[model samples]
Target: MLRIHFTDADLASTRMARAPDALWEVAASLHRFQTRAGRWAYAGWYRTTHARLREQRLDRIVREVLLPLFPRARYFPDFLTPDQSSCADEGLDAALDAIVSTPSGRVGRELALLHGYVRVPAWVRRLTGRQERRDLVAAIRSYHEVAVRPFADQIHARLEAGRSSSCRELLDGGVQGMLAGLGPGMRWQHPVLQVRYPVDRDLHLGGRGIRLVPSYFCWGSPVSLADPGLPPVLIYPLLHEPIAAAPASPLTALLGRTRTTVLRVAASGAGATTGEIARAVGISPSSVSKHTGVLRGAGLLISSRHGGNVLHTLTPAGASMLRTDT
Candidate 1:
């Protein structure tokens, strides 16, 4: 179990990431490649990435460098994922910088840990060299382009949904409610929030607060930075049902062009207000309202009154449809 002790100031300062942390996604998604854990939830992505790596001739780099560094069983270096990142490229740069600037002592420690159980590849020794560090960065960039970017839209949609739910929880019940409702095994009990961690640990926030990051790829349990003194951050898996893809032609046939466009616009996670839909789909508000109404009737959207305006969001069915269209 992991107990995260929070102060009053910590509660007040807690906030969610505005967008997905790119490095974190890369780190967490590696589990899919290592095991069959999230196979059902990410079968499509796994199959696609598996083929892409082979097609792009990145199999060796992935197997030799990435797989060992991002093993499923034990700790990898925390520097591989920065505590926070503003954008994907920035995060990638930060991760690569961490690799390049790693002290030989830390590299030796991490290698000893990995080598304790798993078979350490001979080439991993190059990690401490400057030229080899650049090669590692190139491998990461190529792997991400092949393995992650293809499913970027679906990943973004998942993050946006999680963010919306978290924001709503924060608004309705404050930090306590939001914390309590994080996931199945998470419990917020007064000064400390408990998680069903794989190992026993305790984290004292020490009034520094913590950043709550919702991850599209993190599975089973929430993860935190290994170093206790780093700017505190907790990455929890998004409670997303695996959206099943279906034939888009049927929906297109049923709704026709403009209404189908509206459905897709809503599913794009671009702030699903009628006006936002209007602006996004290049249609008037009246037309957006009319189309959203039909979609709501068809069980593709759910609309709620938000003060004077109505917010229309995609239903699970609608999200499934969009995911299928991809």
Candidate 2:
């Protein structure tokens, strides 16, 4: 378990990431390749990513180079997932630049830590070399283009939904409620936030605060930087609803005013709960449920239960249809 001790000041300063952290997503996505623990949730991505890697001829590089460096084990180099504050924005280019510019000493030290956990190839030491770092960055960019970028719309939609949920929690119950609502793996006890983790450790945030990053690829327990001295960040998985296998109805079939309003609500930055949707559309909650059922059947919305309420967000197909209609 990871216990994050927070001072009153830390609580005041804590904030959620407005966008996905590009490098952290890369690390977490690489981890997906290492385990089948949550394979059902990522089955579509797994199959397509495998084919993409083979088609791009990056299969060997990923297996021999990336996997060894980022084993889903106790430690990996922190330098690889640079603090987003150092980048101009959360774009992959900015992140790649940060990785390329990582100080050689820091890279060497972190790699040494990784070496202790898994066999580090002698050539991996060359990452400290400027040209080699650039080469590695190039490879990482290619991998992202093929494996991660294709799902950008889905990722953005999920992050937006998550942020909306967190914002509501914050408004209704303040930071404590937001923290407590951070899915099943985390518990917000006063003065400290306890997280299920692979190892036991304590992090005392001395008023530097922490950034709560919601990641699409991250699964199971949340991840934190190994070195606590760095700016504190907690990267946690976004809740993924299982994709329904029902055949989708055409967009033309979903043009009713009420259904259109429902689609818009799901697309909104502040995603709607079933009760909220019923209120918005001036319909009964049971009527709203039937509407959401049709939307889910058409692959236009995904509903997941949070606490006692069910939250709805647009699937990529749903968002696309909303966009085309508008």
Candidate 3:
């Protein structure tokens, strides 16, 4: 377990990132390609992403160069994901610069860990070389464009949804409540936020508050920068639909206005309870329960009991049925 020791000052300064970090998504998406864990959640996007990569002949290069460097293992280089930037290209530029300028000692150590999992290319050995740097940058940019860019709309929607929900957590419960509700494998007990980490570790945040970054691609448990000395930030997964959603024609046609609104409310990824949905749609709990039962029966939503309340979220089909306004 990873223990994040927080001071009172840290609580005051905790903040959520307004947007997704591009370079981090690139890394996380690569991790997704190697697994079947969350396949059901991102099925639609996964099928198309693979086909596009293979068609462009980018899959081989990505597998050879990028995947090895950013493996789903313990020690991906921190420089590959820079602090948030206004644009993906801007973030990529900064991250690439960091890679090229990384100290040889740190590069060797990190790469040694990476090499343990996969063979490192000869070009990767010469980190500071201009030609090698250019090659690496081009490879990352190509992969991002081909495999990741097509789902930009879905990514943005998930980021926005996560930010909105996080804001409500902050308002309703303050920093401790917000942290506790981050996701599974996380708990907040006063001064320390505990996580079920892959490796046991601890973070002593004396005063510098941690940045809570919501990621569309981060899966399983929340991930933190390996080096504790760096500025503290936690990258957590967001509940997202696999593909870009179209307007719910079939659902709307089948269910009428009120029930459709109820499904749409569940699809918001907020895990709202019955009462919350009723309040949002101006209906009563009994009415909300009726709508939810029908939706769940149709496999459009799933409700889980959380203490006295039940929280609802969309299933794969449910997410596909809903429309996102880009």
Candidate 4:
């Protein structure tokens, strides 16, 4: 077992071990870090939430913690030399996912600050309103001349239980297999993907029962922003029911195209029929129905049938969207 302690007001790392208790403890500490960072991110970006922050935080931990610990004289001396890729490849997206997927706290915090800090230089450089991009990458080399690595038991346990076959499996299982593979004489095939050091000299090992792979957060590529192939970055909405009922406007992007039509159709005061709305908006009756459906979806309007004719009236959302001198 391993233990690291912290207070409510701060997040810091104080312990290390190559055992189950220790690795998981590191995980918990990192999770707290992620939670705290998430709060900051939420406050910084009004529309963001905790879940999204958690992923980024975890990524940072791997970017910083795991990479720094493996080399020195104290651990992993036996595994480096001949084989490389025994470690994680170095990149923001790769590092973040590697740690957070552990679903641990301590590791999460360490990772967030680590990645965030490294990214700072580049981010700062890119933001001066000057057109530019930043670059931050380092090579993955074995922390040779060392022995023993973090999470010895956790890694061994996973290997013993099976799950150590490929790089993808290890990444998918996360800490479970990575720790398991953290023996001696083993290295990673993808250095850019995560940390690689010699666990031993003969082979790549560890990885068993890993499940929670962290989501990808790449600031470099515009195409990656909404890529489904990227691990899912969930942002749990904090609202309990609609906050003050969506500001009395249900739609997020209907301002330019539909605003005028909406106002003209609803101007009769008593509201308008579907045909009347189509005439007013200069669109087909079916199109009016579609717009009405959207408005209704937004909690902005309501529709009712009077015999063969249907009437549409403004709800609070609709009225808010339709503002005139009267």
Judge candidate 2 against the unseen true structure and give its global Cα lDDT, from 0 to 1.
0.84
Candidate 4 lDDT over 1-326, as tens digits, reads 11111122111111111212222222222332333333432232222322443444534534453334221221211111111111233222333233223233433343344444343223322222212111111212111101112223322322222222223345665433443343322222332112222221111112111121111110111110112222211111111111111233533334434544554455432566776566544577787888788778878788889688777777866676655312
Model 3 scores a TM of 0.75
Please write out the lDDT profile of model 3 over residues 105-199, one tens digit for every residue: 77677666666766667767675455676788788888888767777765765676676577678789988878978877788998999988888
Alpha-carbon deviation at 177 in model 3, angstroms? 1.8
Best by lDDT: 2
How does model 4 fare in lDDT?
Answer: 0.33
Candidate 2 colliding pairs, count: 0
List model 1 lDDT by residue over 117-165, tens digit each. Answer: 5787888776767777778778888888888767666676567656666
Return the TM-score for each candidate structure: 0.79, 0.78, 0.75, 0.22
Q: Report the candidate with higher lDDT, 1 versus 4.
A: 1
**Candidates arranged by TM-score, highest first:** 1, 2, 3, 4
Q: Which regions in candidate 3 have their CA more than 4 angstroms from the true location?
A: 84-89, 116-123, 128-130, 241-253, 256-266, 271-326
RMSD of every prediction: 5.3, 8.7, 8.8, 23.0
Clashes of each: 0, 0, 0, 61
lDDT of 1 at 35: 81
Window of ten residues with lowest summed lDDT in model 1:
239-248
